[model samples]
Target: MVIHQNFLPLASSGLPVGKIYLGYLFIRPVHNPETPFKMDVSFIKHWKKRTTLEVGHRGMGNSYTKCAVARENSIHSLNKASERGADYVEFDVQLTKDKIPVIFHDFHVMVSVAKRSPEKDVHQIAVKDLKLDQLRLLHLDHVQHHSNTPLNEQVIKVTGENDEAEDLRPFPTLIEALQNVSTDVGFNVEIKFPMVQEDGINECENYFEHNEFLDRILKDVFLHGGKRRIVFSSFDPDICTMVATKQNKYPVLFLCCGANTRHQVYQDERTRTSLTAVNFAAGCGILGVNFHSEDVLRDHSPITKAKQLGLISFVWGDELNDKTNVEFMKKTVGVDGVIYDRIGETELRSSVFMLEKAKKNELFSKKIPSPVQTPRAGSVHFLNDQPKIPGLNLSQSVNQPHHEWPISSSSRRRSPTVTTEAEKYFAASHGLIQLNQGYLPQQLTTAREV
Candidate 1:
């Protein structure tokens, strides 16, 4: 079991406080004990003070409803989002018939077939039924209500002509995306699981087993994720549960329709409302909740409630397309992240993560001053004239005698190892220690002053 201690600032409420108060501690039990890997989740959780992260939905934007530069979930779209300054890009991932995870939004694709008639006939087929090779060969089009009618439209092209480049083509594998997309950009992978809609209809029938499906995708991510920031989200509560328990490497977010009038709600009770979603996420030790825009706009109390529970909140939906709504969510509601379409359409901005990284580099790159001479013999002085590193306790080092400083046994055999105050500050700030074992006490006791 992993116990996460979340410290929140309490100065705003006018209460007597130290630097920070222990807001809450949540326990996440390991369901798959055999899985040995664990990940640091501080990057996603510790973003309240920074600017709200902007994520490009389905990479630049969903191509079905709105006109997009490239096909949704294509490599072209993902790179476009990275170039446009999105902190993270959200895309849908589902397995093909051969269990190859591919990036696609819908469960079915429209394929054009030529027959005796002069016009080509269109047929709708589930993406899971087709192999990877067959799916790539077929000229795909958007699924239509009238399948009998002959329409020669291609899904990738905005205009009437089929002039899309290879990168703009759909059905790119999950591995392909991990390899080709910008390493600086993060990825919000939405697991495509079949769910029961509000109207007693299944989104897709006879899908792969939940465990097998999730395992396949997780394997691909673990093998190729490297240092990229990644988060897994799903509307299905079961999928979210499995994702959280199966591996501790990535954070899982419960996607909620959240009492919205815009779209049909799923039959699952957890996804029916944002409040219930928060309750479920908190109870399950899940990282956060991604609320639909319609519900939060109507009553933003859910976001406040999420923050109170120490759960990160992100807003998504078609309503986020409007720049005004995006600002309201970011400034007024104070969401951790926002997923929208047509990123950089109004204005281009650098990622908040990248900006913070640059600042850290600039701050650390400045040369440190040499140790100053002390009045007394066998004494050393530091930081008297140098800029102080944040979170570093310099007083302890300055007051202690040079010979009395704690040194590791290995240092005694060789030259004395110097653990700089800046190194300690950076280690603690970046969560270099193991998270599942608890960090605060361990970092304090183990990090000795040199």
Candidate 2:
């Protein structure tokens, strides 16, 4: 997007109004005494169209974020992500004082000060200084459901079955998240703290009494395991080691960051540059690595080398600063995923994928001369084409998506029905993800039913 600005005065107010030239469109400012505002945006030349990775940032990216949606860790947000075409979602979970594993991100809750001490105003008091119960009464300013509104307002107004759906949102337990997630999408679960003391933060008394919290999370994860892929991550080496050793089924990812970040990783860990932080994770015999994208670019190096070592790489950052960065990571660096702030963005990119998928399905129908079944993007159909149905028009129109698609795929959709001289023909589910469930219109068929 390239933007050019021009200013004009309002006849009513004599204030300078602005008009922005963005490509062919003229954009005007929104209610700010400005005539028109222009923002010229363009992506990096090196980074073009790339596959948009599925991601979940906390729950709903709304007001109360401390994993407090009664169903915050509920299946709703996860299902919402699914609707948005997310391939996977990220969440933070940790242990509570009761040794129960809970899904929460921040270390403290923001509470208003207790009623004035009968003297001076107590408004200056910090929320963290208050006890858990005191904080409980006070609502979070940032609710996952509504952005930065008062939690009390959201709670009073929210209409759901449980408190999780209510406003003062208590954190979701680990069992709660495990039960809620989609079996198909992958999970990027960041363990809130470590099992043992690194220096002082993860001491047994502070974080958990025993490793029972870890055990409980892993147990629930394994017991109800479905098609969902699991990736466990933590800044604590002890926790990383435990996940690697104790859980044999899922993949373990080591999370590393700088001082201001949630957890710290030693500088010695940057051995694999081309492959990025994924190399360090592989070195530890874990599955992958999640690094700050700021570290990815600011380091001024490539991580492709690390990829050769079989390390899965991912970046978390404001990659959306420009869509070009998204292309750079996927096309040039070949990262496994990029987590970001907006879930709606993922949908725009997915539409491109669906369009390409449609084209590929058409190409597939050409090579196989069988039932001539064509499944719609995001849908599946059992077709029995007839003279009444008429053959599909090959050149009706090109299905173009609003967004750009990622790298070209190596595989193509296979024909669902196969008929041969020697073998009998049958049907199978098309391999497209999120296959729709419905029937072709009655006007579409006179052929035999399956």
Candidate 3:
């Protein structure tokens, strides 16, 4: 649990040990009543039921590389993902020069400026340097690389200067997304913060102060995120810590590149590997770790370690685009969620939470017969004539007739009745069930007991 002294300067400061001081402003940890020490696992309760969530990456897909329906992080992209039945939609959020939280991915954006020649001169500008109005007035392109790398062939043209539709435009405000997107779909809000790369280059020079930066974003979310299932994540461990301390309504996940060969690793020690990220997350008392697909594909033991620690495991990266890899993570590797591009393109799937809700409603609507009491001593009773409900796991009594519940093929493949320690922890914490106790037949009869 050692924090680098350089990351947090506390020398000669009169503030508390965990409190961070930036100039004259003191940042103190705020306790959330909902989740005092850990994140509220109720958001992803279905994960324990073997329902691996499908989160749309940057909405429908990353527009720069993938063939997405709309610009990445745009309002249209998020709404499309919701319509496609994605359980959750992940998007990057950073602050504009005006301190407005806006959805965008890269730290730098390529702004097309008019020149004397026919072709417009493109300039790479840091997103934080531009005001919201100024950013909305520029034709922006995704910056792939600084060393003359060609722009992506599939890049969605973001014409913020023209009279384009609001939904199709890039840099949609955070408040706008909270209001317009479907409430059924959860949000995996990745807080965008600049960091040092493995090559000793800073992602963005002279970015906003961490404390002030997080404050503004948290303010927006707190004010606008009404009853929405939200989870905050960040590659910067400090940002994750700040977010976890700032609010209790939503959970915080540490985003780790892990052991990836596709991109240069970050300089942060906490993000060097999935194992280290897990240790950091466990030590920080956060919810879980979002490991890159490369690391998990290389060695899935980290996910096992995460599960053992009762932490939620989520995988993200370009490797998730392959259907086989997605299946491997979902079935073989056993991750809680997968963040990928073009969700529902390979095979259409509904949100696991939504499906579970429907199943609960259907199960409760029918009258479940109570177990018949037997007058004979030392003998088990059987409900041989009771009709079994689909997708419901009925308790089996000794010497009773074995009845198999009819379940769809897809349901059997995706979800199993087997429970995990993480699920037990959630069920106990949320008062859904008593720890180390099996569900009785009567418990299944009520929605609250279940």
Per-residue lDDT tens digits of candidate 1, residues 1-450?
Answer: 332432222222232222222532122343333345444432333433567899999999988767877778899999999999999999999999999999988898777778998977767789999999888876666764324644555443321235767688788999999999999899999999988777887788878766678888988997888888899999877678767766776788999998888776776667788899999888778889999998998999988888999998889998899999999999999998999998987896987777888999999999999886544431122211233455545335543323232323542221123366643553354334434322221223544532
The predicted structure with the larger TM-score, 1 or 2, is: 1
Candidate 2 global lDDT: 0.47
Once fitted onto the true fold, the runs of candidate 2 whose alpha carbons sit more than 4 angstroms away are: 1-52, 62-75, 110-113, 116-170, 194-205, 258-279, 300-302, 346-450
Residues 274-295 of candidate 2: C-alpha lDDT, one tens digit per residue: 2434544565567666766766
Query: Best-fitting candidate, measured by lDDT?
Result: 3
Compute the lDDT for candidate 3. 0.75
Steric clashes per prediction: 0, 35, 0
Query: Candidate 1, which segments miss by more than 4 Å at Cα?
Result: 1-49, 144-164, 372-450
Give lDDT for model 1. Answer: 0.75
Residue 340 accuracy (lDDT) in model 3: 93
Per-candidate local distance difference test:
0.75, 0.47, 0.75
lDDT of 2 at 105: 59
**Superposition error at 67 for model 3 (Å):** 1.9
